[model samples]
Target: MKKGLRGLYYSRNEMDEMVAPLKFALVGKFSSGTPSIARIRARFAFWSSKDFSPSAESLVVPVWVSLLNLPVAFFHRKSIHNIACLLGSPLKIDEPTTDYTRPSFARVCVEVNHLDPLVNDIWLGDDDGDITQKVMYKNLPLYCPTCSHYGHVERNCLLKAPKNKNTPDVDSTSQEDLRIILDKKKSKLVEQPS
Candidate 1:
């Protein structure tokens, strides 16, 4: 992975170090003309310079959000930045968007707080008339609202408390109990006629 990253963003004075498992902190001179790092995706991994620590209670991730059907007048840098602010802190705008090569949509990298409900669409224009612009996200991470964290959905949130007392907490379930349950299921399956 390190070699692949070096090949992609080559810099003579670049320094890369592993910060955590499957995570790396890269310090290097990258071309400003290059596409936004948020847009770069390799398999299940994405790149970001955001200060997202492992122990952070709140979840934040850099996401490439596309504002579809945006008016041509709003294609400029300032306008795109303002629109991106409605979603999150604007990180960087794609080259195509700044160059006006892709008029269909304006892509901007934004630092999105996962705890907040994402804006699906937004109204653009004055009081006389308005248009609904669809907001599309690239590689948005799974977020757990209950825990206010990323990497898991609400249903699978580890911090969520059980409604009934009899309902065993998944984490509290003993290894012996799990083994016994598995054995019982296996026996039941074996006893059934094939």
Candidate 2:
């Protein structure tokens, strides 16, 4: 009954495509024609830093050593470089090193995704190698192809009324009026001169 409910949730095409090969083979042990069952797990990975030199090769790859214990090893192929023992709940790789030179300071750029996206200032390392101070939020403007203006994006622009180009531009007309008035004033001043 549990197998029938699980099968109903996923389409036959999805079950065939997504089910692992090992799980599919295991299902054959059960009664005639039941969909394969496999428990899914997510593995998250992120780099410590991204400023490695192009000349230096074999970037450090950290892999979990055991599920029972919190430990990882930086390995390249079959060769292991360093074994990191995670003591804290949230593991942190302090000053991840490469095969090449180690930098005294590592500059990192952080971005906040919100209503207005921003790129933070360059983070400087302290004596203790800890980051300090809140970085200023620099607004990144969106470019609209339709109006060719920067600031608010395309969708917001469409809601506003379209500008009429058929009528002469206000700036040009104002400049022309000013020129004519100046010419008339100059003519009157010249005629009054002795």
Candidate 3:
């Protein structure tokens, strides 16, 4: 499940301010696993506000905590907590809490599995968070390796020029390579004598 667009002109620190006490998964996390109530429990964890940096509209949970609760966190398909306890994994039955007092917001994350065969698992929702927004139905686009972008699904990228290359960034790129690209385009036009 995707939320609405989160980042337009938010800086690292600014993002923190808006989504303070909110946690999110970094781009490189692996939350795609089989959809089991138990495994879903493991993905859920507490996210500290200090380390709450996350991708646009994507929530981030702590790896350590999410990993621990894998077995009995999610109750989507079935909530057989008693059965789980019989096997040894204990279940936590508490009200969802995302208090501002604590630095970390604890959540139970489940592997976002896709019902359709084509699309990847969009994050549906977490057991310990409020993801009941209307916009969540319009899932956020999947991550892309080629353009290094999110928001739009990779297959949907149709722009001629790469968008990220044009964004003003913190690190200054050397002009040598950029100049070469500009020159290459110029020479291609000259070939037509235009």
* Top-scoring candidate (TM-score): 1
lDDT of 2 at 13: 48
TM-score of every model? 0.57, 0.19, 0.21
Q: List runs of model 2 lying over 4 Å from the truth.
A: 1-105, 110-133, 136-174, 181-194
- Tens digits of per-residue lDDT for model 3, 1-194: 24541111223454344354245523232345568987665645332346554553332211111212222222211322222222223334222322222222223222232222222112223333322211111232464444545555556765534557554442465677667767888898989853
Judge candidate 1 against the unseen true structure and give its global Cα lDDT, from 0 to 1.
0.68
Query: What lDDT does each candidate get?
Result: 0.68, 0.32, 0.34
Q: TM-score of the candidate numbered 1?
A: 0.57
User: Which residue ranges in model 3 land beyond 4 Å of their true spot?
Assistant: 1-112, 115-136, 143-174
Q: Residue 136 in candidate 1 has what lDDT?
A: 99
Best by lDDT: 1
Every candidate's CA RMSD: 16.0, 22.4, 18.8
Comparing 2 with 3 on lDDT, the higher-scoring candidate is 3
- lDDT at 44, model 1: 24
**TM-score, structure 2 vs. true:** 0.19
